[model samples]
Target: MNDYSKAARAADRVRIVELDAEIQELQARIRLLQLERYPCQQRLDAHRYPVLALPNEIVGEIFVHFLPLYPDTPPLTGIYSPTTLTHICSQWREIALATPKLW
Candidate 1:
């Protein structure tokens, strides 16, 4: 009976160790995915961002798409939604601000 109990505990310990190792592996994979995604995000941001000569209407359209839909307005503070729009640069801030529908 003692030996059987010891074996069961040992098995449980091994299973716990295996689960821990798998969690570590998953964490590493998540980190790897984030590293892989950062460049992709930058590329996407570049493509999405208007650094140069696109028309203001087009830029306004883009800003309009970034505003949040359902939240109650954030007061006259002039911040709008979809999060990433206002969180970006000065030019982006202006574009988001000027789009009449954004607020």
Candidate 2:
């Protein structure tokens, strides 16, 4: 190759090395960010259902309101039933069963 071509090839090799280093730095930064994100994401996931954080009394009251007005009663089984609430989760089942108004 001519001197000019040889010089250009050497420059290209240097640029390629610099680019590879930059890529590695970016990848390391991404890994660090992901590591930082994980626990915060776990915390966020813990609170994903905000309603679950409410006090049992408040949740029971909310369940009471969800039923038909006082004079009417929800069915024993099916989507609208309080039994369905018992099936949702242990905490909810305990709350639903304890709340006389639900039955």
Candidate 3:
């Protein structure tokens, strides 16, 4: 029937219009998310950078472990010995004193 065919065509047109609107909204949301992530993407694009962050106390401990000390040495030599941990930088010396294991 002519009426039936007309109704079918109208229904088809309405479905197609709704599908187009849904596709357009999906594209808009994708564009918005891309803009939101643009800065983070730029940061990720940069090269890696190296850093030095070992604490002075850690350095002093390491040097103390490597030092040569004689337990039987006189107290005077213990105070003036080059092998003493404090002969290094003042900061390292202070750390070594606080961490007596360095002696």
- The per-model lDDT (C-alpha) reads 0.72, 0.91, 0.63
Count of backbone collisions in candidate 2: 0
Error of 2 at 52 (Å): 1.6
* Candidate 1 accuracy as lDDT: 0.72
**What TM-score does candidate 3 reach?**
0.40
Alpha-carbon runs more than 4 Å astray in model 3:
1-4, 47-103
lDDT by residue (1-103, candidate 3, tens digit) is 3666977999999999999999999999999999999987666644321111357666656655555565633232464443465675565566666765544
Backbone clash numbers for all candidates listed: 1, 0, 0
List the candidates' TM-scores in order.
0.47, 0.56, 0.40
Give residue 24's error in model 2 in angstroms. Answer: 32
lDDT of 1 by residue, 1-103 (tens): 3666977999999999999999999999999999999999888887877463577678878766655554555344445543456567777677767777776
- Which whole-number lDDT from 0 to 100 does residue 48 have in model 3? 29
**Number of clashes in model 3?**
0
